[model samples]
Target: MTASLVSEPLDIASIRADFPILQKILPEGQPLVYLDNAATAQKPRAVIDKLVEVFEGYNANANRAAHTLAAMIDLELDAARSKVAALLNARSTDEVIFTPGTTAGLNMLAWGWARKFLKPGDELVISLMEHHANFVPWQQAALATGATLKFFPLTPDGRLDLDRLSETITPQTRLVALTAMSNVLGTINPIAAIAARVREVGAVFVVDGAQSVPHGPVDVQNPDIDFLVFSAHKIYGPTGVGVLYGKESRLRELEPSIFGGNMIRSVRVDGSEWADLPARFEAGTPAIAEAIALGTAIDYVQAIGLDRIAAHERMLTERAYAGLSEIDGLRILGPAVAHRGAILAFTVEGVHPRDLGELLDQQRGIAIRVGHHCAMPLHESLGLASSARASFAVYNTRDEADALVNGVARAVKSLRRKRS
Candidate 1:
């Protein structure tokens, strides 16, 4: 269903019941306020139960045996792939390849495609907002292949300057890799416009959707993306499972950099032919239980409805920005509330982020992320050594936003007094 079609507001209390950890009280006897969703989300009972079900029953290698358990595993594996394909609105199940995580998928692309296609004097365009997962692979690929790596400079407000798109991407550009949303800045990039420019220049467009996929709907066919990658753990699923959605033609052309038993059509003494589409890239025995449980996570989100989840988190972000703006020394890192995700990255004057994070956790039972958050270059570009981030999800409440504001204000007062 569309975003506009979400008729009723989400019942958060009922939703929180699905995740038992929400009821947890910290060792300090304070209730937990989990705001570190961008790092990883806590799993629901549905996902946990799904994992147990998969492991307890029919736990066997998929796609190679005639036994009952093996056949069951094969069917479950196919169903999991189909679920992931539906989540991304990919063209077909063949487009989705399972990897260990988003890092693995992007690394696979870097090794498989960049190594094969990129050459001397070619340009690889990226942005200052990319997480290291998307950044380092291309950077290393350029270093290895003698290609030049160009960056799209950020606007004054920390969003990608789309005006620089034309200047950055040229005919010589072989690939344009960017994050759909910045994990640090919480800025959502314009995918259609950027993808169009990349297409016009005949460059392969790859998206790091690790931050975006869990927040909202992603339609691959509509934007004509060559490849998009995201991790399951970020969306209330198990860790160690990721998805790489590549266009059918792109997957057909990409050489499998990983080699093992399940990926080959026939193995001879000489070189062997590879399997088709996804199996070509997914080498070895995959994460069967994790992948199956990931499908359950997808189902959990769908049942709650992505549009509803987005709206709920948007409300939470609005409350957070409004409350945090009232603090005297605090400065938010990204654009005004309208263009950001549920993340609020900020720094308080005279207060180190690590110190502030400790205060929030130890004294207030608030869980936030501190440090560069895996986007050190972005932080450096913004003239910040580090920052604290509080990201929201569907089950988060408005009261928790108030608690964060109160806790930070109190922490800042105590910290400044100690300095005095």
Candidate 2:
């Protein structure tokens, strides 16, 4: 289903109560104001309780044995897969393959698909704002396959220059990889528009949804996205669990990069037959507890509704953007709030990001992400060594946004005084 901005407000107080960490007080006696959502989000009670239930109730190897405990675990695993498929609006549950996280899923595609299919004279296109998880794999793939790697230039406002699509994606372009939302710039790319362009050139479209899936609704079928990847930890679920979604036809074409137990249909001394669609990709023992807990996380998010969450985050992002803009010599990255998600990354003149981060945490207990945020290329492109980023979530508040701004202002004053 397509997500539209909703006018109904979220009960931020109620939502905050679901996350126990939000109530944490720092050692310095300041209440925590967490704004580092782009890195990872705090877990809700529902998700945490699910993890406990999995371990305490029926801990067994999923889909491996016929015993009662294994059967129960298998049921939970299937439910989680169904939840992820429903979340992404995938055509089939088999389209979703479990990975350790987004990084593993991307690496699987690079090694299994790109390295296998790409050859010399072929072009692989990616954007400049990709996180290292998305960028490094393709760079390595190109190096191995002798394929030419090309980049989509960004607009001055840090958006992919869609106007140059024709020039970038040509007949020789075999694959186009891009992020649905930038972790560093918080710029939301037009996935559907770009997917259509990739289809026109008969190129595979891979979307890194690590930062976008948690914030809004994503229908993979609507965009006809060939492949998509995202992490559970970023969506208030347990870490070490992620999803790789591929079109049924596309997945069948990809050779499984990883091989081991549970991923094989039959094995002989000389050769072994691969398992069905998803199982073929999911090798070894999967993250049983984390994957199951991810279903609960999806249940929690779906209960609140993504449209409502998006609208709430938009309001907070706008508030933070306006506040940060007022700071002297502070330059916020990416486009206006309307063009981006609920993230604010800015660099203050003569103020190191690490120092500001330390002051915010030690003094104000305001948690924000600093440094390149795993997007060193994006930082380099912006001509910055690092930036301080404050990303919002559904549970965040106007007061928290204010705290970030006020804390930054205070930290800037202190840091500037020391510099002088």
Candidate 3:
């Protein structure tokens, strides 16, 4: 069903039923309260069934053969591309390239574009709040090309310091890569505003949308984003598949990073010609079933409506924030609930995040992410070695949020008492 066909308000109970895993009870004899959405979301039955259908019915190499199974796979792959393009409001399906995951997408750009284009005096700008996937690739690109790498500092509350954009994204800036929503802080960056600035400076803008795309709507055309990358597993789809969206012009500028079977137009002894827009980047036989199931996942969310999901998750985040705030020594990261998505990361004065995570899981089957969360720089900026994170999704409820807060409070008290 299309977004236009979805008019009914979200029925939380019915929506939760779509994900079979939510109904599961842990080995500890407690119902699983999954709050690690920032890592990955549980797959809905629709997506799971799609995967089964693809593998069972017609599993063949896409865009490679003229046989019936191959034709079916080709059709499904094309449909999935169209769905992704529509979701991003991309100008064309040709702009969407399937990859292994978000990490591969970012690495493709860093190697294909940055390493190829950036020179000694050129600068690449990123933010302190970037995931390591967004951070390390740019660092490598800068190191290889002798380009200067700069970081956009964060405000005291963990939001990007847009005021310093002029200084960071200068005329010499070749590219600016950052996360749309921070995995750790949950701070939602103003992508349109940032894209506009990057456009003004004639620099390529790449948004790591792994955290943002699952939570809300993202239009690639509005402010003219040069590139955007996100994963399927983070949005209730199967893992090992993701999308990289690039403007046609921007995509044309980069050489294909991965070279293999399907990506070549013609091969010769001396040189080779690349295939068209998407096929040029998708080099090998991809995760066929996973990519197809991603389309189903998209359908599931669009049917429920992103606006409703955002609203529900916002309410959960607020409930979690308020409850966690009441704890004496718990310090929540990032801005107020109004400025962030449905993620709450925090550090308690006397309790370690690892101990807290263990307690929550062992006692209440409350699954949360702990440690630096692959964002060591952001944690260091906050003067913390690690923090515990509870992220909400559409399947999550206020009760689960309360459970997290209460579980954390109890864990903190227990741990602190043991320390004493």
Candidate 4:
């Protein structure tokens, strides 16, 4: 299969060369193979340099300052917002509101909308595949509003159990929150389909696009979604920067999560009011430096081409599935879901997942994630304590995949042969 298709020059070798960490050799003399992209991707030199430049050269508060340095920082911040909007195919930059990260964004949405829309009889539907970032905010919101939280089950094949959803989503459903991709199982959900169904029930659709945005193309316009949240760090950008995309109309109905500073327009001794849709959402001084770095990161990825990135990871995923399957007592939990983004989680028999992870680290200099991956509900559903996960990015090559395969196999064998 590798020979059948022309392996286009991903130029990731050159890209990897740009990352200083990639060049370092361990004291044990092993090369690093980063397979933990889903957890957090390594920042490129450009992003790092940009962060330094902003923090050192033009360090200033955005939106609150009138000086030259402050104006420069504000310009950079606005540019970052534009880049985020462009990435999501948003009509204008105003739809994009910056946050600390996806978790913060989700929390903001839940806080703002729950009280305004949810009531005692209302329902909030989420897929069983949701990561805790997507699931917990609404879950708590439902609790606060006395609204019911319902989870749609997954298909036997590990995809969303959409067939059962028609029955699950009733007239009282106020919101449907779903993950765009399964971080643990590597299942890419049919969010557009789910969005359509949610709209039919007169419910608002809130998408956790944290995984989906980094993997490939995502257009908020296409889904007609009410709200979308994603983290910049996962997409090879800086930490402390995230995006919250809300439909303009829906933004009007929601109240501000935090009440202070820039978000307000009028304040009396007794009462106050908010600014506009997007501004009202951003309460305090945002992550200025990180946002600028995120802009640069977005530019880098877009120039590299997300489609090509997706295709490269697709090849790697296929190779990973086949190679890892040969290991004894290892089990893949998700759909042998072929059309997934490059995130795979598996459980190893007769060995602790944490032990396997440590072995891969110490013996092979490979970084693979272990645990429920923050989705405790899904792991418990399958009766698993934890699992091993390897998520890929565009910079990963066939050699890295080969290293991962060998690393995993070696770890399992070593663990099983250990004397009691």
Candidate 5:
């Protein structure tokens, strides 16, 4: 396929070779067409090799021991944080904290920071299209703190309706938490504009970058984001590890919620002193090898370039949108192709999402996500119980998208015939 605007021509064949999983052959010799990137991306060989090296070469606990292995592991861990900070254009390495995933990071901020600042009658704003990861934490925080939770309504095309921003985000709103992009709808939110409004109200802005960061560039410093959360696995890194970026001042203001061995500077009988910025939040032993491997994954993506990756995915999205739009009863659930990312969530008239998904996988080895996509509120708002989703990534190809459309058409035809 030709490259998109502002992007260099990508040798997709060479790029696909880096991912070993892409070479898998199905039972009927069908090649796997992975379209579930919105959930978790497939890892590259470089990241895989790095993980093996970390485990075999230096398997030591970091920050506590004085041994050579420990020192080496600590350096690797620091390097990982530095790479992540650079990726997000964070002001300082100290501002970046490691967590299990985006869910853990959001939960940490909600329970630790929001609960601390939120009071009765205070308001917290979120969007209806948020994944449950970003939604439930704030909901529970509001319930616990007696703060009122407000939702920003969606436009007809699934974009956040920020026209009444002042009305939705009142002065009483202590915090505004929303996704940088919808995991279900693929709608990229205007974060900088939203941040400005949240700042106008003198409230904290927390961005769930679980979807956006992996697909495109995210400069936290430029956006004036107070807190940002994203997972490693979504960016072709290892699972079980994520990053949380907070402004240094903001991070220092809130106390750490999770307490344990490494998080404390001093543990006295009377009280305990917390460690500095990042260490304060990282309580237990971190995912040592996984974090280091995540650094390698970042390296892998940066080498290809984020702009090129995004451009490539956008092209694929355009192709997929055109193909899927032709199906007789398929109804897409997002903005136009120009406004959205590579995700396409839609419902077929007479087919259950699971049935469609199973047919795609079983018949053609086309792997697509089906169901609420962890955005039950978004589906409920859209008047859909569930929908099939095809999300693209850097490694996805034009032919794979066509295969998905063809499989869907065949499935719809057969399912309808059986009903008749």
Candidate 6:
């Protein structure tokens, strides 16, 4: 949809109705309870319809077209960039570059940093609680540049140890790549403090904002984030589209990762000059349709208001945490604290998380994520191979939390009876 379908402006019920898939049924003859929003949120109809509209209405490659459809596509792409820049409080829309997803964005940063600023024995600091996307890229970059990769350890309560963090940054530190929030632990990191420490070492700070931007307010300027990346799919938008936001100063210093059509000014017989700020990073044909759809998603979110959404999610999280904690033989991971973000991770005694997840689906149609949740280091710190997660979103309710607790209790009882 080019515009939202709400009759009265900014009504959440009217807005929720715009999401077609929210009404789907599950195999157990129960209403589907989607708790895996942390992995990827369901798209609203506005986003889906916009994708169709762009593809069927004016499908064309961006930035290279003299044709009408190509111009239309480029216009949509540019509007999407402007929306994203506004979301991040960026100085200019040109600061935002579209990539495949957060993984591609991180790799782009790693590639450019490794090629340009890295030197032998220089240090790059990250946290123990990073997704593999954030962790592996730095490792590869270190290998390629002969830089040392340093990781800050976590505190017992699932927070970053700030003392060690202060100690870790040194004159040798060139870059610090870390997640703004832990995907598995659901811990909202102290970004301002981290950025401050990074400044003392004269290093650029990059945040993997894949999880943070989806859940709460994100101002890149407020965080002093030199560079940040997040995916559209995780934020109630479409897959195959992501954004990389960089400070203009830092971006000017970075080398282009990919060399091709849209990224070039002029290609000589022997060499080439790269394009400016964002276009330099965005190499070839962009995902125009998906980018436009993401802009639609941004509109959808603003209509509902992120502050209200965050508050509602925290309420649901508190109810769920209380329900889960009252049950025996279960332990919550992360900080078992209230006023936390909208994710919950926990392990059950004598039950495999996979089995619990399968049973929850088969018996109650409840969807919960089960596994390391891509933060293996956090799980290892908790001495868990895998844990069950029931994440919250705008559509989730207190009733859904009740059903989840009762479902898990039933599973535990059944397993115990078998043992008896």
lDDT of each: 0.92, 0.93, 0.92, 0.86, 0.91, 0.84
List where candidate 5 sits over 4 angstroms from the true fold.
1-5
Candidate 6 segments exceeding 4 Å error: 1-15
Off by over 4 Å in 4: 1-7
Tens-place lDDT digits, model 3, residues 63-109: 99989999999999999999999999999999999999999999999
Q: Give the count of colliding residue pairs in each prediction.
A: 0, 0, 0, 0, 0, 1
lDDT of 5 by residue, 1-420 (tens): 234544676789999999999999988789999999999999999999999999899989988999999999999999999999999999889999999999999999998898899999999999899999999999999999999999997899999887988899989999999999898888999898899998898999999999999888889978798999999999999999999899999998877889998999999999999998789999999998899998998998888888888888999999989999999999889999988998999998988899989988988899999989999988998888899999999999999988888889999998888878
Give per-residue CA lDDT, model 2, range 193-273, as digits (tens).
899889999999999999999999999999889999999999999999999999999999999988999899999999999
Question: Residue 407 CA error for candidate 1 (Å)?
Answer: 1.1
Location of the lowest summed lDDT over 10 successive residues in candidate 4 = 1-10
User: Which pairs clash inside model 3?
Assistant: none
lDDT of 2 at 230: 97
* Total clashing pairs in model 3: 0
**TM-score quality measure for candidate 2:** 0.98
Prediction 4 global C-alpha lDDT: 0.86
**Candidate 6 deviates by what RMSD?**
3.6
Q: How do all models score by TM-score?
A: 0.98, 0.98, 0.97, 0.96, 0.98, 0.94
Q: Which stretches of candidate 1 lie over 4 Å from their true place?
A: 2-7
Could you tell me which 10 consecutive residues in candidate 5 have the lowest summed lDDT? Answer: 1-10
Positional deviation of residue 141's Cα in model 1 after best superposition, in angstroms: 0.2
Is 1 or 5 the stronger prediction by lDDT?
1
Q: Which has the better TM-score: candidate 4, or candidate 5?
A: 5
Writing each residue's lDDT as its tens digit, candidate 1 over 268-356 gives: 99779998877998889999899999999999999998888888899889998999999998999999889999999999999999999
RMSD of 5: 1.8
Q: Candidate 6 lDDT, tens digit per residue, 1-420?
A: 222332223344565577687688876688788889889998888898899999889998888869999889888888988999988899898789899999999998899865578989899988878998998889899988889999877778787788787678888888999888787877878889999888888899999999888877789888688999999999899999999999999888877888889899989999999887789998888777888899998888877766667767777788888888887898887776552578888898888889889889888888899999887876887888899998987777778888888888898788767767
Q: Residue 44, candidate 1: how far off, in angstroms?
A: 0.7
Model 5 reaches what TM-score against the true structure? 0.98
TM-score for predicted model 1 compared with the true structure: 0.98
